[model samples]
Target: MWHISEYDIDKAVIKLRHENADFRRRLKHEMLLPTDIENIICMASFGIIHLELQPQIIKCKKQ
Candidate 1:
């Protein structure tokens, strides 16, 4: 299980903001930018997807 800290989230948000700016700059016309809510959803989705793809390990104890 991954333990995400506030610092990690902040870093991700910064990276995402930079990407968004680049995309916006490339567009000839203005478009609606992602809202804060959308960003939060994206972060949550990333975490869930990552967890789903990660390998599960099972532990057994011999009695």
Candidate 2:
């Protein structure tokens, strides 16, 4: 979703870091760290989204 905007990276970084703070932490004073947001944006650039479906996790049976 962010790979457009004429491929503008600077604006992307600021928007992501500044706008998406609660996504990283819930504390009122806590915000997404600079390095962490940068890393996230970098991964997003590669279309890589990491998530864990805790309730859907199922162990495979051993043969």
Candidate 3:
């Protein structure tokens, strides 16, 4: 898990909106874990990271 800033969220949204394929490829190549993606989503949904700066709080447990 990671704490993402509002700026990072905006940048990620823009990058995804314009270059989803590239973003996915990069995320995979960069070895981003599932928790990373969950944190990103939470940041975007809340529109602010400061309110909830916890990491890996929303990650799914491995089987």
The candidate that achieves the highest lDDT relative to the unseen native structure? 3
Model 2 C-alpha lDDT per residue in residues 1-63, reported as the tens digit of each score: 434343554555555657767632422344434454445555546545443333332332445
Cα displacement (Å) at residue 21, model 1: 3.7
Question: How well is each residue in 12-57 modelled by candidate 1, as lDDT tens digits?
Answer: 6566667776534523233323443245335745655332222332
| Candidate numbers, best TM-score first, in rank order | 1, 3, 2
- In terms of TM-score, the best-performing candidate is 1
TM-score (all chains, Cα) for each model:
0.34, 0.28, 0.31
Q: Point out where model 2 deviates above 4 Å.
A: 1-30, 47-63
Better of 1 and 2 by TM-score: 1
Which has the better TM-score: candidate 1, or candidate 3? Answer: 1
lDDT per residue, candidate 3, 1-63, as tens digits? 656567877776566646666556546456444555654666575644434334532333445
Q: List pairs with backbone clashes in candidate 1.
A: none
Candidate 1 Cα outliers beyond 4 Å, as residue runs: 22-63
The number of residue pairs in model 3 that clash at the backbone is: 0
